[model samples]
Target: MPVDSKLTASSEKLIPEKQIAGKLLAHYDRHARTLPWRAPPGANATDPYRVWLSEIMLQQTTVAAVIPYFQKFTTRWPDVSALAAADEAELMAAWAGLGYYARARNLIACARAVVRDHDGAFPPDADTLRSLPGVGAYTSAAISAIAFGRRAVAVDANVERVVARLFAIDTPLPGGRREIDAAADGITPDARAGDFTQAMMDLGATICTSRKPACGICPLREDCAAFRTADPAAFPVKAAKKAKPHRTGHAWWIENGGDVWLERRPDKGLLGGMRGVPTSVWRVAGGGEGDSPPDYPFAGRWTALSDPVVHIFTHFSLALTVHTVRAERDCMAGRDGEWWPKADLASAGLPTLFGKVAAAAMREELPCP
Candidate 1:
């Protein structure tokens, strides 16, 4: 049934908030995403620990990628105390392939903080949750609303998009975030806020997507101003993307009989706390970076692979030219690194970029003699 509904606080016309909340909640009751970290819609209470963990993992990562990781982490560390007590190296290894390595570091810090500062239980309010490590505006709001059922407006990327389209806010993001936040606040109901926020997220994820929103069957179709317009996807206007800078570096690969020398990255900058092949400083490509490899970790005969290992990060793309060294077992004595058996390289906690370099450094690709 179509009914006039209030979508934002400052809209010109009058529409009922109850109408919007009722329809959205009804839709959520019928079609909610069954995620590992989520409880049933009307369960007594959701585990705040799981909520916090999932929210942390889901930052800048997709649900599909997070599912297996979430399952593995939950299986290994069943509770907050367990995670707080887990080994940093083991945790970083488990978090190997997941980009944004800083999140993993923050995860450990947040867990420890929760245990030490809050007595192993997550505080229920947004303000208190914000005090914990790595729990920012969006994260704290999500924890509060989803875990505690507070009326905190949790506007993640999905919720932001949904709110932007619901009201047809044509303002570009960053600049328009204030308006979007206000509109999200307006739509958040006084009751069942957790369900309401989750419903909005579901609506954005499943129906009102970035491309070709399913306006015909959307639960809020009647109330959506963008749906009334032909091109609903364009409502959430985004700023133009600037080109990512490019960087080039050299990696030193030392392979003995069947073992490889791996170095742990310094615990400060990019890919920190992960074990990977030794590498030289990364400099911007073409800015004095020539086709020739300039430096090596040790003085030895090195064979540089013709092709470079290319990996993209949020801010830049990297091209690491791998140079392999055939050396004796003790040749890596000067370098503070470990010699791991090639067969167990999978267990090594190499970041994705380094993993690519490692693959290129392997001798397995050649045909058997």
Candidate 2:
């Protein structure tokens, strides 16, 4: 048979979506990441809650860390209904140390939304799935494709790295995200597209890694433009790193008869609307040191405690020193702030950072680590 020049040209120009899909499927067949969400063949099971929960937990968190948390959550709550009925304080406590409090709040909201609006059923289609709280394009696509077998593209960090390297595009991250998404969409296959998406994730995470990529083991190494050029490391261009801002602040430590007082922060700004220890304004001072105490939540024989708790926010770092005080019996009313017994402190919904500060203060450790 005469050689088909057009087929050859097309193959050279761009790997056909189907073949790209097939190659990845074969790779996955040989080595799929053994995730709990993946349904076993002929198991006859699918839980949207499980899928949704995993996707949410996986955000800004690694799969290895999220697996145990996932196991704990599903084992504890079991389903949307159970999670919906779960006490808010307990939910927040369960979500402690997760960092993002908004995610936890939205998780509860979305769970309730699922129970109320969807009759405890997660929408299988991407469009309908996106309607849920905390769900975005990537999350919706992930849940739809991974759980419901819907054809959709999920562009997460791992997928972004894979696409950027394959095309040999170095537009720079965050800024180059759009270009990466377009390239990913171009290569996405029709059949078993879901598996292909996950394959890309696995390849990027394990083989086409950000640093020290195992190009020799990459299934698509032959087709990778970056690999062919012998500069896979240089493929993903990056922008200059900006210095993170540092803010100075003071967190109040009000103790009364071995009980600690905590407050629910306003529903906006840093740690918005979450339960936390009372804090003064978080800003730097003229001397480049932390600002002075802005006044206690109320007035009394307020004694300043030594040392501070330093926390790093996305935009800035906060070095909060404790200024404890022995308040009088009729201290000012702490609106939304209550005094909880030291023993029962864990029940209230306090942010992990604050919880750590509180625990350290209770221990009276000098300069808490």
Candidate 3:
């Protein structure tokens, strides 16, 4: 039968639920992405550690980018107990460049909690798993269903798009979040609920993409109302977002001969515990009026440089104009700092963005215009 006719039949509850189940299963068998978290054929079970790790990494990150990180973590830590025992510096280093440093911190905290509170076992129930640090409702549902085979409604961005389009739901998300969850739960199957949850995620990520959905290839095309109406993109409506704020700060570029000075940032703010060139507080004004040079007891020529270095945090974009000073080695005694050779800076573990700025400095002369 034609897709439109099938959808029409399904809409009125004329088609048997068994038929829908059969078609969805057949579609998934032919098209599902073979992922690491997936239970291998004939495997007796899934590893909770692997499931938890992948889910955490997948948060706000793509699968392709996450695979290598996931592999590295598992290879190093292997399980919750090992992860719980990871040194703070080692764990943070492993997580560098992944962004969201706080997630890495929470990953360590949750691992330790799992080891301490649950005896190294991830809790099986959604409620219990939700109690773990960084485990939100969606994550809890995903881990519980995928790792423990509990029936749960895992609503990710892709899943949300797919559900909204399938039901022709015109309500704007996240205002529509609740309704969309209901629609997803309506179609969630009982047996292999885990597999069904994963299938939805896969379908959304692939065939039912946010842009240019492949309706012809979608398994649910026969029953997708928005596709028949030729307005699938319109179903998952959205509200316009407010513009992100922009802030300005200054990084101190203190060099003596060929060595640069760097200090470890405090443990609780932006870029916490990361080694960086001493910087002024990032604020609403780009190093606004009254911002002064950092207190350095040593005497040096502080040359103000132009053309700010820009970086985007999750909530805002930052433009940091820097000031550089060439100091004598004897002057290092006046400051609380470490002298790192310009050549050895890379091994000192600079964040990727700062590393770029440093590399630029190496390629240019003073002022780095």
What are the Cα lDDT values of the candidates? Answer: 0.86, 0.77, 0.77
* Tens digit per residue, CA lDDT, model 2, 279-314: 777775456553664566775555555566777777
Model 2 backbone overlap count? 3
Off by over 4 Å in 1: 1-15, 364-369
| Candidate 2 runs further than 4 Å off | 1-9, 12-15, 40-45, 285-290, 332-334, 365-369
Ten consecutive residues with minimal summed lDDT in candidate 3? 360-369
| Pairs that collide, model 3 | none
Write down the RMSD of candidate 2 (Cα, Å).
3.5
Best by lDDT: 1
lDDT of 2 at 172: 84
Candidates sorted by TM-score, descending order? Answer: 1, 2, 3
Identify the candidate with maximal TM-score: 1
Q: Write the per-residue lDDT of candidate 3 for residues 125-175, one digit (tens) a residue.
A: 999999999899999999888888888889999889988887788888789
